[model samples]
Target: MKFNQYIFLLFSLFFLMSNSYAEINIKKCKANQGDYIIFDEYDSQIAEKIIDYKLHNQPEKRENSIIKIFANENSDDRNYWLASIQTDNKAEDYLFYQVDQNKFTEVDQQQFQILLPKIVECNQIKEVPIYSENFDAD
Candidate 1:
């Protein structure tokens, strides 16, 4: 009887905690480059431009959001950066991009596919290079 009571209490507590939790807010999008983009709101258009990003929606997503874009002598592109946008939850699952400086011309496109699909409570997302010495790589 005592075991049953404890089990019931545990489940009740779990339900309450889950209900009290809120949807994750994208505080920042960390990318591979030396820079990162921050998004308080969901902007599908902006997210398409950035190359690599880390979504702070959850721990799994946060860790998965870390995308790596490598540039080398053989690489054609010299400059690469990460960008993110705040979009409405009801908006399209995929983010479409257009040229803002060129009067909304279609320049490029990126799909908001999560490389990391787990959710972690993150206050902010800052760019931290995987191979950077600052992160104790040495």
Candidate 2:
């Protein structure tokens, strides 16, 4: 009986360690950008960069806005870009994301509260068009 328990404990530890390592590797891959490595909680490394981006752009045009880029929770797809638009005062300005080759969707405050009861917030997200332009080839 003791031998069986030891085997089970070892197996569990091995599984847990391997699983965590895989997750860390994936996060590292996603966070890699040129010479800099973005760790799981390395916002400070890029915080100045985002702030600098806002500073360089014209305030009248950009409205002191910055887009905080984040990796998608669902990583099975590689063609999507997920981010959030932030204002200087507000924490949640809007969810700005791109899907495949289509439009850039924005989930603003008006649409965020329409989730169904007891449903998860992120899973309940639906894409909504933020901009569209029509052109004539003729």
Question: Scored by CA lDDT, what does every candidate get?
Answer: 0.29, 0.37
The positional error of residue 37 in candidate 1, measured at the CA in angstroms, is: 14
Instruction: Estimate, for each residue in 64-135, the C-alpha lDDT of model 1 and write its tens digit.
Output: 332332111111221222223223242222222222321211112232233112111121232332121112
lDDT of 1 at 45: 29
Global lDDT of model 1: 0.29
**For every model shown, what is its TM-score relative to the native structure?**
0.21, 0.28
Cα lDDT tens digits for candidate 2, 12-64: 99989665521111121122224422233333333333333434545543455
Regions of candidate 1 where Cα sits further than 4 Å from its true position: 25-138
Per-model C-alpha RMSD: 16.3, 18.9
Alpha carbon lDDT of residue 122, candidate 2?
27
